[model samples]
Target: MLAIGMDLGGTAVKAVVIDHYGNVLKTMSKPLGQHATSIDEWNWKGVVKSVAADLMEEFKGRITAMGMSAPGICNEENTAIYSMPGRFYGLEKFIWTEYLDHETWILNDAHSALMAEAQFGAAKGYKHAILLTLGTGVGGGIIIDGKLLQGRNMMAGHLGHITVDADNPELDIFKIPGSIEDHIGNATIEKRTYNRYEATHELEAAYRAGDPVATYVWLSSVRKLSIAMCSLINALSPEVFVLGGGIAQAGDSLMKPLAAFMEIHEWRPRGEGVPVVVAHHGEHAGAIGAAAFAIRQSTK
Candidate 1:
């Protein structure tokens, strides 16, 4: 009936307590003190301990299950992170179950974000759905017939890595050029601009003002994203797409262009369009999904 979730971000650890009905009863976040650099297992465990202890201290016995929203690929049992960029160093060697009393189910942040959107935010009734969070990187997940789809390795949902171009300069974690994340990731934008804007807002502002350079960069990113979406359209044909993360905060600035580009590229035989919507959940989404996922998994 109750569960706790943790969103283990590169910079912060977000945790939440939620009921079976998808209501967030309580939440909190603790700073992990770094970005992109992995903290050692001992310190990482301490941070997790602090987050779990703080939430459990308040909700105490009210919690029923626990889960984690991690940054990258997870193992079959979801107990250890097998591989990731900026992974928690030594996490594969360290074990949480040894120190914690609760069993946990861990999912990639992208997958967890998708679950959160599906369970508590957007795409509620859609049987087939996809989520793309455009932030420091592009993250995505897919749902089919009302179930989270996972492959044999439980790492099948790396939608960001799907190739959009063959000759582009940008590259993904696998060193593939022109991947969706390589083109649209926040880091990619930064690399293109050469640190001219400290925040995505400045670049967005430039684009809004019709600055040619910014417009080109932004629209190009959108086009590549559209290509990726169209591929998904032709292959999986998901009913809806939920876009979240920081850059998606640009709202209509993103959706307007994204919609237009997708229209031209996607296969619309019957003229039916897949609605692209913004994520409604705030920062608590990943944490909420982790908790909800744990609860859902326990029932099975």
Candidate 2:
């Protein structure tokens, strides 16, 4: 029936009410208020309560279950956040379920995105799939045999941390170079284009004009992304790879080169040509996935 979904982002929080079919009946968003540099348990609980209260007030009894997509490693039960490397300061100690009704389900935001794709978007019919979202950072989700793979410690599908380059490493929390995120994230695109403050339109225009710098930058990003995809293809052999998030709007400009690279690098001869498709749901995938999770939890 109906469910409530919340996507807790670094800068903003998005909440939505959806039916079992993944239709958004109503939605709301708000800027994340002042958060401690280290997000303590109290602060984390407070934030969830405040946001949930706002949505619950409107939907009221219509909500059957609730799901939250946050940016860290969620506990196996999906009741608490175990770790969030750089962004969520004091989250390690927070038990999210304590802040909500016991019926709520919590999951990694990336996982939620993948669930959305698997349930209603690009990976709808695929038995195995991977969802990669390129935005402020690279986030990913993995599904095998039509089920989400929550590896040991519930951190299996963190595709962004996978190292693409060992020799020229991109140093991050894990000290790995050329992390998937480092190579293809929006921040990297902004840096490469030399338009840190320019909008996506300007960068797209530059690419259209055949600017050498922009071309090189764009291709470089695509190459890095393709390498990561090829690795995933070799490892998981998913039937489809769904790319979403802001940069994915580049369409063929990004997909064409990625396709070529995947063809060249993928190890599996039979599945070398796995389709790389854009997510139909776009930014709404997270919300939809959250809703789906909520529905599933309620049914249980």
Candidate 3:
């Protein structure tokens, strides 16, 4: 069977057509024009509708099952976004099923990324795993005992908001002080570096060139990330931790140091270590995962 998966992002809307075997038959992305800074100008509802319509038409309306990944809490029914504040106006309680004229399954983007990795990417065969998307901020999901843990509110996999430091007073959006997101998320780069660097990529470039300050900042972030992972290892004991997102594009610059730190911090009882690998699906993970998720749901 074939299905459609769509990821609604801040800047663009990505969609894919895929079969049950996880082969992507077609992929397309639509820019959401310029991002609106305020709620009044947040124009996304119409664009998403158009994108969905266009995709359906292109496939001659044969593709029926659809799934969406968005940046918010998805309802238990997976019909609409449950709650999302400060962006994507009209997304809250906006029913994709009603708008798209199809029964659409919706999931949080981070959770969707995990689903993609768990379904066909890094953690394909693993029954238990963790996925972390390290970009503008840290977002994560958990798969436990061969199932995605979508807590009571469908909010279980929020790994980024966990506290890493008690002494630090800085709070993230969730009001958690010194959380992992504050330490390693790209959103915190300027604040963490005292405005020395504006983005993680620039810091990584400087770190590569042997710049002392950049090296310090970059490694510090990775060290905190490793620390968080070690704590998670003790708590969840996932078989593997898959890393994704834009900052993860640093390749060995991020992985090698992270490995070193994990070796130092992670406690292994039998000397067995959990592997931390990069995500296989890359940028299209959300969309692909959404499609895969829809296909799975359809089969069920």
- Model 1 misses residue 271 by how many Å? 1.5
* Clashing pairs for predicted structure model 2, backbone only: 38-90, 39-89, 39-90, 169-177, 170-177, 170-178
Candidate 1 C-alpha lDDT tens digits along 206-233: 9999888888888888888889988987
In model 3, what are the clashing residue pairs, if there are any?
A: none
Candidates sorted on TM-score, descending: 3, 1, 2
What does candidate 3's lDDT look like per residue over 205-261, in tens digits?
Answer: 999999999999999999999999999989999999999999888998999999999
RMSD of each: 2.1, 2.8, 1.5
lDDT of 3 at 18: 82
Best-fitting candidate, scored by TM-score: 3
Q: Report the lDDT of model 2 for residue 21.
A: 82
What alpha-carbon RMSD in Å does predicted model 3 have with respect to the real structure? 1.5
Compared with the true structure, model 1 gives a TM-score of 0.93
Instruction: Report the poorest 10 consecutive residues by lDDT, candidate 3.
Output: 35-44
Question: What are the TM-scores, per candidate, against the unseen true structure?
Answer: 0.93, 0.88, 0.96
